[model samples]
Target: MKSVTRSLRILEAVAQHQPVTVGELTKMFGLPKSTVQRTLVTLNEAGWLRANRKDTTRWEIGARVLAVRPAALQGSSLFAAAREPMIRLRDTLNETIHLSVPDALQSMVVVDRVDCTHAVRTFHAIGDTSPLHATATGRAILAHLPKADIDELVEHGLERFGDSTPTDDGQLRADLARVRADGYSVNRKQYRPDVCAVAAPILDEDGTPLATVAASMPESRYDEQRVPELGRLIADAAKEIAARRNGA
Candidate 1:
């Protein structure tokens, strides 16, 4: 009984502070290092947790956890609110549309998606995760985060995923500033070499980001001249989703 309770508690903690290290979990629970490690290993084996892809020493939520949950949005209001707008955006642009929410400040997890009919469209599994510094979906949310939170994420180090990924703190901050000013973000093969995306955030009543909606496609299909139009469309969709979610 005690073991089960501890395991559940540890799982909740991991969900709250994902990409967390075992040493950090140990400190959080005030448990022995060995005990925390054993629990983490057990959870990993059970498919409730997995090591972070960028840093294997840290743990994050796994696909099975999302798979077993009802509708996989963790009961988020954003999912229901964004569904229609996401579909409309996909139909309008003929590109894949994704809805992602922050996993703490570590990464953005795809909670929902509307797929386009194009054979070469970009795709992300519903539970897939992407770095907050390197993807348009992530940058949209990151741009709205509190400065202290952004500072903490930057201090943790941004791992470069591709040539276009912003690794330097100054560059990343500049990119985020552009996102704030433009009301959207653009990713040009930043996270995935073949993909390009434009995204905007769904903000809560307090103007904090609740989720992001992105229109993604293969780099070969991206049109630089259409970026402003695409950005405006995505931003409008995001605003509509936010309004619906907030019952406004």
Candidate 2:
């Protein structure tokens, strides 16, 4: 019972100050480093807290926590919560807008979308699955996933979908790190030869990603100079969906 209580306390601390280091957690709990490390290892294995991919020294709440909690926007209501924002974004950018959630299989699945009317545009069905390391929408959610989950994907190896896909483990890791820092991800004809995209995570109150929002366009219409702007717009739209969920 004492061990269980200590584990909960450590989890609480991680939830309060996520991406925290062992030294910080030890200091916060006034416990020995060994004790904290042992508890952290247990929690991490159980999917309670995950190490940060960028800096393994730090830890954050894991994907398991998100799995136990219902998605911020889920079921039929998810479309209701996301439709307006998706349409608004598509209108603003004239690009295909996507709303997707990471599924039990650790793959991202599109739930809703607003298609661009352009002669040359990207499109996907409502239930299409995307590769975690190849698609912007997938990476956006993956960037916020627990390190243990990320490691599982890495161990499985990133498969190549197109010429631009990052097949190298180190390269993909670096890309995920960049996504974490930028709060978004971009794909340059990675998932499909003609498609370019930018995506952002929709996070819950605990900072766990519940889903992702993405804007995809034809390579001919995508401009490298506009990536940052496009990414920001997508991120803002995703946040609107998350805010609606939180308010409800």
Candidate 3:
């Protein structure tokens, strides 16, 4: 009973401070490092937590954790606010539209999506996760985060998903600057070889990104000449979702 209680507490702590190291959890719980490590390993085996890909010493919430709470997300304020906007965006662009929220600073989790009619459109499951530096929805959220947080994420080392992923620190920073200035982000075969997306952050009243709204399609259908138009449309959709979220 005591071990179960300790494991639950450790899981809660990891959820709150994900991509956290076992040493950090040990210090937080005032438990021996070995005890914390064992609990973490147990949780990892059970699919409640997963080690960060870049730094195996750190742990983050896993797919199973997300899978169990999907109903909660479906009933949440963000989902309610984003649903209409996502559908409208998909209809307008004839491309799959996704609503994603940041999973700590590690990745973006797709919470909902509206599919386009095209047979070859891009697709993402509700619990699908994407690297923050390699996807339009992820970069849109990152661009609105505090500088310190961005610096920490960069220091953690950006994993390369493909040739177009922004792994260079300086280059990523520059790209984020453009995202901020333009109020949107773009991805062209960055995270997925055949996916292209344009997205914008949905900011809360405090101007922090609560989620991102993206229009995604197959790379074969991506039109570079339409980037500015797509950026504007997606940015407007994000603003509408934000407004709806705030009860405006």
Tell me each candidate's RMSD, in Å, in order.
4.2, 12.4, 4.7
The candidate maximizing lDDT is 3
Q: Could you arrange the candidates by lDDT from highest to lowest?
A: 3, 1, 2
TM-score of 1: 0.82
Q: By TM-score, who's the top model here?
A: 1
> Can you give the lDDT of residue 17 in candidate 2?
91
Model 2 residue 152 CA deviation (Å) reads: 0.7
- Weakest lDDT window of 10 consecutive positions for candidate 1: 66-75
CA lDDT of 89 in candidate 3? 85
User: Judged by TM-score relative to the true structure, which candidate is superior, 1 or 2?
Assistant: 1
Ranking by TM-score: 1, 3, 2
- Which segments of model 1 are wrong by more than 4 Å? 9-46, 49-62, 66-75
**lDDT (Cα, tens digit) per residue for candidate 2, span 1-248:** 38999999999899779889999989988999999999999999998899899999999988666544334344655557788999999999998898888774356877777898888788886667778789998888878878888888888888988877988878888899999998899999898888888999989989998788899888899999998898888889988988887775
Residue lDDT tens for model 1, 1-248: 38899999999899888889999998898999999999999989999999999999999988788665326565667778888988999889999998888888877888788899988778788778789999998889889888999899999999999988999899999999999999999999999988999999999999989889899999899999999999999999999999999898
Every candidate's lDDT: 0.90, 0.85, 0.90
TM-score of each: 0.82, 0.68, 0.80
